[model samples]
Target: MTLLPDPAEARAARLACRQGAPRPTAGMAPGFTQCNMISLPKDWAWDFLLYAQRNPKPCPVLDVTDPGSHRTALAPKADLRTDIPLYRIWRDGVLAEETPDATAAWAEHPDLVTFLIGCSFTFETPLQQAGIEVRHIAQGCNVPMFLTDRDCRPAGRLHGKMVVSMRPIPAGRVAEAAMISGRTPAVHGAPVHIGAPEALGIADLSRPDFGDPVQIRPGEVPVFWACGVTPQAALMASKPPFAITHAPGYMFITDVPDTHWQV
Candidate 1:
């Protein structure tokens, strides 16, 4: 396996993404922190911040940029507008456009406040180091994400159902995987559910609201983690006039090391 990525690699990954390499970033910059991004209007910042605070499990915040700023403290030199592999523009609760670059959108909305939220990918390395197979990475695909029946605590104009990223873990190792991940509370600590898609309002494992599906081999049980993508779902349900988010599975790689969040 490749050694843990260094800061240079992290920067290079972001640069590659900025330059238009449209690909999923699951195992990219392994061992470095990766984040989910949401850039909202400054007027709605307080409301969203409260929403995130109210639902920390799915919206754990890492760094929030100042209004109109294109940078985050998570990566001093990284451009939030273009460093992510792909971006989704939401207008009035509808997906407007999917782009590799969001510079134009950022310029149009100068009051945008960017939020860098924690991601489950941070715990992937630890899971791998412990001899577990993260099915999505092993299969070279994006993690499958689904919307649950549970509604999140609403704040201001933000409201939506919880979204979860699923990984099929060996039934015997489900507890071990949860404990390993539980150590990183800042990055979506642990599995919210295990082995029962129906319980989460998911009717099929093959179809996901976001991201691609991975195989669930024999004796492997499905495990779900609170996803930062939940914010996008809230945008749809709450009908925010304008918003920007990292396209599911295409994350913003940060300068922080994964170990920084590990307990």
Candidate 2:
């Protein structure tokens, strides 16, 4: 059985990550939801929100903060500026650098607004409970993510290709995996594609655009899910002046349980 930590303990682990400890959050806090955070200047909030609205599967929103505020309803006591394990700093749509925490970045852009996009990792717990083998977890690596050829509906200045994360499942259990994850729309509910990376214009399963790749065994097929990283791809395409996002696979732990978003 997988060990699941309570929310507070999970937050503490994040705090350690903030202080320079490195860890991927894929299988942590098993019953709690995880989020992908995007922090940007208030000037860019509305367009991004509209973008998220236009593409709900990959960009399902968990929470949004008021202008210049770091606090969110997702985890009242957790500091948005410091809780996520890693953050990607983007300048003019280019990756400027990666840091474990966002304190300095927040200081440079104090007027930033934060959006917490739901993550598919939040649903993996149930998949595991149902006896599905989460391949990346079993392989002990970050879930592999790819950028697709698909275009999202344009919303102001935010528009880009959809991004997806892949996991290998036994051929026979693919439907069961889909059904288990389908219940939580808030966290990217179900598999978008299965068995064909080329169908999505993804050329190679081993060379993912983000996160680490895992092996696909003889009886397993690669399954893809819409990813919150889709917004980061949008950020890259739109060339936002300044932005911050949780590095892929390193998510923000929320106070709410994963089951709260079940449909």
| Best candidate, TM-score | 1
- The TM-score obtained by model 2 is 0.96
On residues 12-42, what C-alpha lDDT tens digit does candidate 1 reach at each position? 8898888966999999988899999999999
Best by lDDT: 1
lDDT of 1 at 58: 98
Model 2, 155: alpha-carbon shift in Å?
0.4
What lDDT does candidate 2 reach at residue 4?
46
Put down candidate 2 lDDT per residue, 1-263, tens digits, no spaces.
44544677667666676776767998876788899999889999999999999999999988999888989998888888888888999999999999987888999987899999999999998999899989888888899999999999999988899999999999999999999999999999988998889999999999999999899899999999999999999989999999999999999988788889999
**Deviation in Å, model 2, residue 233 alpha carbon:** 0.4
TM-score of each: 0.97, 0.96
lDDT score for residue 210 of model 2? 98
Which sections of candidate 1 miss by over 4 Å?
A: 1-4
